[model samples]
Target: MSRRDIVTAIPTSFHADGSLDIEGSRAIFRYVAQSGNEGAFVLGTTGEFPAIDEDEFRALVAAALEDLGGRMRVIVHVGRSSAFEAVRRVEIARELGAREFAALTPYYLASAEGAVESYFEAVSEAVGDGSLFVYVYPKRSGIEVSPALLARLAKLPNVIGAKISEMSLDDIAAYRSVVDDDFVLYTGADRDLVAAGEVGAQGVVSGVSSVLPKPFRALAAAADSGDSETIASAQAAVDDVVRIIGGDMPRMKAALRSMGVADGRSRMALVEPDDEALAEIDRVIAAYR
Candidate 1:
């Protein structure tokens, strides 16, 4: 398997007042490293990279490396509006000992496939390393990266794989059918873990992993081991909690609170899940457990 295997998405750690809690963030990295899972992902959607500044990003990388103690591979997301800034971050991140990089297409406005390709190429050249993976989340970024475009970009010596969040199952299968099997294929949607795995997804970067790492790990293992029943049970467990939390970061945040991990406060502009949402999430988690 490639080094970029199943990676758990990082969670946005916040204080009661909804400020970045570096200590809490470090604790999360440590927890995932020791959770019997492969490793943890940083600066992905759940990490709220869009809201964090460069300093916070550096701090996150530094703290995760310290807490992880080199036990797991660190895949840092470097997507940003300014290509220069993204490239600079990747260079510094490598110096910090991050082995892999994942970056999404630039946001704010959609661009042509050629522009997206050029943007990623610039990042790869700036880092002077071809060991990076592209993050594809058209649903959130307003950029639809066609499989043809991905196939074209994959030609880059450093671009290794693509992490897709939205697409029909048939589209995913079709993309997989066309791409080199050795190229990594990951799903950003956590609830589709089983189906994704079954359809030849090499790994997943799931928001659920921040709070329910064990369950996600179990589900992946079940799928990998061909244990359909186990996969079903685990998927049901994930679906249960996701339904209460509203099935995204909000739900994942509430799950952390239910498990007494994160403080249940998202950064400003993104507050804690409402009381009803939290109560419903708790009820569902309790039933599942």
Candidate 2:
């Protein structure tokens, strides 16, 4: 645990023509590696994963592994709503030196009673990577991974952890009751990091941490040491920054741009923020900077 558990859900950098910005992506990876983050979860929601092509995904994976130089962990999000495609990305990422992998239940299909478990077993067993963290994102995947399912998956030798997106602390407590202390849990929601730490979340797979890695690490440190005042202060700062970015992915891009880290262009489907939102993001980023 400690700060070694902080995982940044790093955003994929993109150019204006909607292509992969390899160096920009490298900048993100470099930032995390230097800022004390222990892991990078690429190609997740903030990365606009659904909008990128397979070739671009491959490039990003290579960039992460190469840049990190084994200094930190890189967990690639290989889920594609198709087991075959997800497995394909896992194979590709493994070929590029990605050691850890993560995935979610099929997004567009109705998984059978045991289909979810079967799908993950197939992928993890196929890749045979060091560890696998199943992503629990009901909103995007449209599939729910019940606590029973999670408990079962915890038994899988290679299935070491999970990236829980929206579970409340109570839900996390329920998961703890089922799985062992060795089963690591990461909160995908930054706003809940402090409470999650109190409820046994080992780390965070945070989108905001891509911009504010230092404070995120501080929050984890305080939580680890039971410093309630520091946790409250750290969470307030993160919440202020999150509110400024709101739900706009592009604002996250702009936040990075404020730090001179990215071009701020996502995929073709995503656009930059409006003048109002852009101004707000800059103002808040200035405060953090």
Candidate 3:
């Protein structure tokens, strides 16, 4: 992958009962691959990494690798609160043939800049030659990656980039101005992919891609072809549709289910979106189409 390909995070498909639906997950993976996206990230935020067990994670990666069969680049997000666990996941991802890896700053209990550096170092040491990108999403993990910290970490032999999940357009531009060319700056927010791209985001790390791969891939292709109009159209379509679902994750799952892709029931602890919510989402998508 030329680092220009849009990289989408794959969500683990779950059955109605909330069990890992490996087959469903594979189907979704195939869907994304066929959509012409450059690559997909397995076991990341949208994959419900925290709720999934170690065995499930292994199985999910193995299944995706088998299905992808080198058709698309596979980037694994091996971040966990525990550095050891993150390293272990990195090893598993490597064993499954994943060449790209991303690790978020550990969540909760803010780590001193040194501790954050140490965590990436431990993961880097474990995953040897695989390309690595720092995953920075402070809202979920109270830790942020400073430009200075990112610059220091980018010097690590195998660390190639930082996945900027929270940086606004100006912030992204500021970081881009300071970072070296070899260091990638992948945008984390799906909704801001176009803005990110305009400011030189290498690619997108999107949760919305789990369901709407076609649109996301379209935006990516536009960026590659230098076609701003097409990018705007695709991004607008997604933003308009996602409006009805808004911040309700359950509704997002329900919306996908309504389209015939089962993403397992929104895991326990989340209230499933009711029929009314689904109708609103349907209406939003229908209006745009």
Most lDDT-accurate candidate: 2
Give the runs in model 1 whose Cα sits over 4 Å from its true position.
Answer: 1-5, 16-18, 225-227, 284-289
* RMSD to truth, every model: 2.6, 2.0, 2.7
**Pairs in steric clash, model 3:** 14-263, 14-264
Higher-scoring candidate on TM-score, 1 or 2: 2
Taking all chains together, each candidate's TM-score versus the true structure is 0.89, 0.92, 0.89
- Candidate 1 lDDT, 1-289, residue by residue in tens: 2222457787768777767888778767776777655666788887888888878888889888787747777788888866887887888777777768888888878688888888898887765653788888877888888778888878787878778887766667866876897888887777776677657677777766666566666666666666678768877877765555533676676676677765546774665567787787777667654
- Against the reference, the lDDT scores of all candidates come to 0.74, 0.79, 0.75
Clashes of 3: 2
Q: In terms of lDDT, which candidate is stronger, 2 or 3?
A: 2
lDDT of 2 by residue, 1-289 (tens): 4433777777778787776788888887887778777778888887788887889888888888888756778888888888888889988888888778888778877676488888888787866846888888887777888889999988876888888887678877787778888788988877777777668777778887778766677677777777778778877887887687644577778888878887757774656788998788787777775
What lDDT does candidate 1 reach at residue 88?
Answer: 78
184-224, model 3: which lDDT tens digit per residue? 88887777666776676777777666565666656556656
Candidate 3 to truth, TM: 0.89
In candidate 1, position 41 carries an lDDT of 74
